[model samples]
Target: MSFVAPWFLVALLLVPAAAAVYVWWERRRTRGAEPWATAPLMPSVTRGGSRRHRHVAPAIYLLAAAVLIVALARPQHDVTKKIEQATVMLVTDRSGSMRSADLKPNRMEAVKAAASSFLDQVPAQIRVGALAFNQKTKLLASPTTDRARVKNALNTLTGAGSTATGDALAAALAIVRPQGAAGVQTPAAVVLLSDGANVRGRDPIALARRAGRLKVPVYTIALGTDEGTLTSKRANGTTKTERVPPDREAMRQIADASGGTTSDAPTTEALQAVYKRLGSAVAEQPGKDQLTSLPVGIALVLLVVGAGVSLRLTGRIV
Candidate 1:
């Protein structure tokens, strides 16, 4: 618990002071009272009522004052809440290298399965977008809460052409940037799944720096093994084998530049684990909640109880 106006707590000293004054006055009035003659002859004179019950109302009143004083301080508590309005841009590399038979049936198929599972795990309220990049980058789906649309876009992705990692990042950033109401940017994240290094378009590192300036972290997942190979079809209909190993160094650099983390997923299971972790990371948001109303409500209840008890016991409300 914390207080916004902590200085208001100084008023709490008045409660104890009021109690002390009541005690002193009661003692003084008792000392100055006339003594009844033959008081020892009557048992009721010495045992009129329970002393504990006599002080209950006063104690309650004092507690009520203390509670009210605390409420004036504007107490607050830390709370972790789900970010319902946050946007997550899924940037996938559909370059020809993603067809390498390094993970399961193929890198692209494994990624699509893992990505779909990730979508299912994330909160339904969180807006998700998808972008596919190869020799060129294009927005497959704009950010929206329609899970069906995002999933459909992922299913339509086909691996072909060269890698354009920089263009993909730029496109994802554009989709995740601040929009609508007051131009205030919502909390956002980018999940980039790639298997090979950039071979065309702009430099990925430069675009990563831009994303960093915009405060958008790009989590990079390098998927594939060092022995990964791809079979390419030539113009003459001949097939040629080519090495398409995972570009861990390039992915790590991009993640670092954009204030994000990089993970190496050499297997389909590892890729799913990465997506699950990202789902949790992107869901929770930390904030402070004022607790003044709680203390205020407690004080009101105490005041009512004190008044009722005083009237029932003393024939007058305090």
Candidate 2:
């Protein structure tokens, strides 16, 4: 156990001195005692409940002193191994159809929540950027390690326009390709969250094919349950959910063509699974070395032992 401030150890020298003073005082008190036929009974009388409580006092003092000394040395702990730096980019759909409430609240809201969690779990070394798209895709932030900016960009998005899978994919890859160092990992990836509705530009399948050639894996998150539902607000107030078209399988195919697997999770939980899988499948880079857990653990042991000793001296066995 390394000390944050080693000077605190000087306090321990007081323990032996305090013990000597206690022994000296005990011997001086006994020197004046009178001899008696019931001399052995004296110990029993002194050992009654009240006397027992006093027996714990010395231990308590020792324990308190120990705690104070340990507290003087600060401690900290970390168990998880550190990860290396990496870059990740995401392309998400904000098409008009994403406004559907099939995924609860709406598809886009669910996507936003899932994206935020994924971003939060990513190691600090990983640079992440995001793209939000409808008719035309827009780069909300360049690939950056400043996570707050990426998440802020995600939260500000609102759904509108028609779905354009091709333009969005091409544009997102454009953002990822140049950011990578020569011979270093593409470091960039594309996670497309949509219902597989490709209406605005080129064919989505063709884009997926292009991604496969570019070594970019396009992971797809298919949103909605069987017999999908949609909610739209009318001019006269009030809202309602009605059965809408379902297109889960098409999204899955997009994933397959792009060398990425697809899974169905109609709720926010699905998005979580998707993001977790992405993290697990991807590899991290390299960086700085630091310590963890060892120092904190030693301090904890000392604290527990001192506390136990103090409690035992208080008349109850620890």
Candidate 3:
């Protein structure tokens, strides 16, 4: 129940005004009808031949007028347009540490769920790509408008190796970074979903600077509680979620250097909110209404013609 031309609502005032004038005319036409002394015996003729139409015709005409007003106001249904879509890439860590159950069923599951939801919300217009990283980074999907495919890629992520945030980010850029020669300016971005644990390659800060030079913004979506814990299981099938430590400070440095933003969520809803913001930032253009719907305009015209015909038939006997 949304309106494209909300300003059309102001036209409703004419309907009530027309009704009031019609009612007043009817009263004036009927007033003093029996002033004559022989009025009781004098023959009288009602305006309507069919008793049901005494009020129906006027009501029908009013409805027709209302329909015409709305049609002229240019009513539009579900319509959209995509002029420009921001280039968005995702970099996710799938290391063993990502399996910590600090966020929910597990951090890995949360990441998958979040990625899936974000893909679903991406309006089918933006070009989005996804990648996962452990000891090495893999491009799960390339920049595409096919959101379902991207979500399918997210579902394939598994946590069993060490994290390489820097490498993963570099690989994601390789897949998403556009060739700046189409006479087009496409701002690129990467959403880094990680536990802030980096254990491979050169300093993450240096990589962040490189990202800046490449004109790629990196938004960090951190998934962990301030007092979250990590767990390790042995061959005996024993496990525990121990409060090893938190490493937000390291993640912050990467996010800040890339001239990007970071968001922390403790609940699913908060995580969802973070994803929505990131998704919006990545999606540059959405859909819109190009013109008023033809079917509605035709229907209104038919109603007006029907009303005019009714009035003509009523005038034939006069």
Candidate 1 C-alpha lDDT tens digits along 183-255: 7777888999899889888899998988887777899999999999998788999999988898999999999
True-structure lDDT of candidate 2: 0.68
Write one digit per residue (lDDT tens) for candidate 3, span 1-318: 345666876897999998999888866665644455254532344354353455566776677667666666676545443436567888888877776777788777888888887887776767888888888888888888888888889998877788788888777666655453244556678898877578896567787777777767788876777666777887899986666243667778888998787787665667778888777766543334534556366656666665665666465311
TM-score of each: 0.65, 0.56, 0.58
Find the candidate with the highest lDDT and give its number: 1
Which of 1 and 2 is ahead in TM-score?
1
TM-score of 2: 0.56
Clash totals for all candidate models: 0, 2, 5
Ranking by TM-score: 1, 3, 2
Q: What residue runs in model 2 are displaced by over 4 Å at the alpha carbon?
A: 1-85, 179-185, 233-246, 284-318
* Candidate 3 segments exceeding 4 Å error: 1-83, 178-185, 235-241, 244-246, 284-318
lDDT of candidate 2 over 1-318, digit per residue (tens): 355666877887887788678667655544434353256665543323343454455654565566566666543333344346555777887766677777777777888888888887777777788888889889999989898899899998887777888888888777776543345554446777776477768777887877776667777777766666666777889887766443667677778787776777677677787777776544442223323344345556655665565455444433
Residue 151 lDDT (model 1): 87
Query: Clashing pairs in model 3?
Result: 80-287, 80-288, 81-286, 81-287, 81-288
CA lDDT, candidate 3, residue 253: 84
